[model samples]
Target: MMQKEWTTCFPFLNQMPDDERRRFLQSAVPHQLYAGEVVVREHSKCVGVVFVLSGELKVYKVSESGREVALYSVFPGEAALLTVNCMVAQETPVADVSLAAMQESLIAIIPSSAFFYLYSVSPQLQQFIFSCMYKKFNAIIDLVEKMTFKNVSERLYEYIRENTGSGRIPLYTTHAQLAARLGTSREVVTRCLKKMQRAGFLQTERGKISLLEKPEP
Candidate 1:
């Protein structure tokens, strides 16, 4: 029987026919990730697709100066299929990113060859891949827009709003992390944050941040 938690992470898998799901699951090899471990490295030959079964993974790219810029994060059920795409195309990844486990995690890896064979034989699998790709593309578009049009403060606010979902963004990240996401220096982020705080837009405490007012859209 498929675990209830697994269904929550992979709702689509729950809808699949039992036999199909079983077969697909069989193709996935399980592995463990310790906290702070790198699950994947950019430009490394992708051998398979990896799906997080538990915990959180931070996907980040290194800037030219070697600063880490966080791209996004993936939790349970989210598969890093872009790596598989790179492998299939035999192309080097454009970004130098790594997947670091924020907590202990379990991952399921499916070989690229097996995935291709299964995708060819199963229309459902193909549809799933396309849908995932579409969403990934949209996310990339959103990121590009933010990076291009928004200032550092605006970008930081947008990220906080989206991640918190409740207007109140907890300030757990370091200033250095914020700087990377903002494409600036830690001092710059610190100065901007202080300015915002003085303007009554936000309040920052020890490792915590509260949004005091919504920025004008």
Candidate 2:
């Protein structure tokens, strides 16, 4: 990516001191990730600070049964902060914590050594990193709360409602994929979806689920 394009994704670079910004941009490595590619594997050493320029990245964990449970997604203008903790500590992640491209994506990475240097000297970089990390942390916390306190059916309803936003909306994900995102089995998701369908809440077709009407209180 051109320097201009990179700057456009991370506008905070404009606020950084010239020398610091220059060093950071000079060290960054851009990579193109294809859909379904696993960019970072579980229990590995930190890759670096990943900057998503476009498309999406999914952060997930693999259970012993080989089921993948999604933690969250990183989109354009966002960074996957899970790596930040590992990067700063110079240690492998404690959890399975893996990252995969949810779709074709462009990402720029600052190597761990360069990141530490830039983070120390550039307050703007520090602020930007921490701000992103804080937001992602809050999202993870909310996900945890829901997973712990809500049943699969309730979570499924909320997921559909939240994604629907307003009006009938089509979601382009398979039952297995929704199961992964909601930390459940495909059969469970399918049953819950069938129940919802019977209740006039949604309609399911191959590779798609569409909201039909809002659930009553």
TM-score of 2: 0.92
lDDT (Cα) of model 1 = 0.72
Per-residue accuracy of model 2 over 42-126 as CA lDDT, tens digit each: 8877768888999999999998899989989998888877677677664544325899998899988888889888888888888
lDDT winner among the candidates?
2
Off by over 4 Å in 1: 1-4, 14-19, 91-96, 102-104, 166-169, 214-217
What TM-score, computed on C-alpha atoms, does each candidate reach? 0.81, 0.92
lDDT of 1 by residue, 1-217 (tens): 2467666777777667787777778788888889778877775666777778888777778766887776666767677755556666745533245667767888888877777776667666667677767776777777778889988888877766665565554656668767766667888788888988888777877656777765574
Task: Give the range where candidate 1 is weakest over 10 consecutive residues by summed lDDT.
Answer: 90-99
lDDT value for model 2: 0.85
lDDT of each: 0.72, 0.85
Alpha-carbon shift of residue 8 in model 2 (angstroms): 2.6
Clashing residue pairs for model 1: 171-209
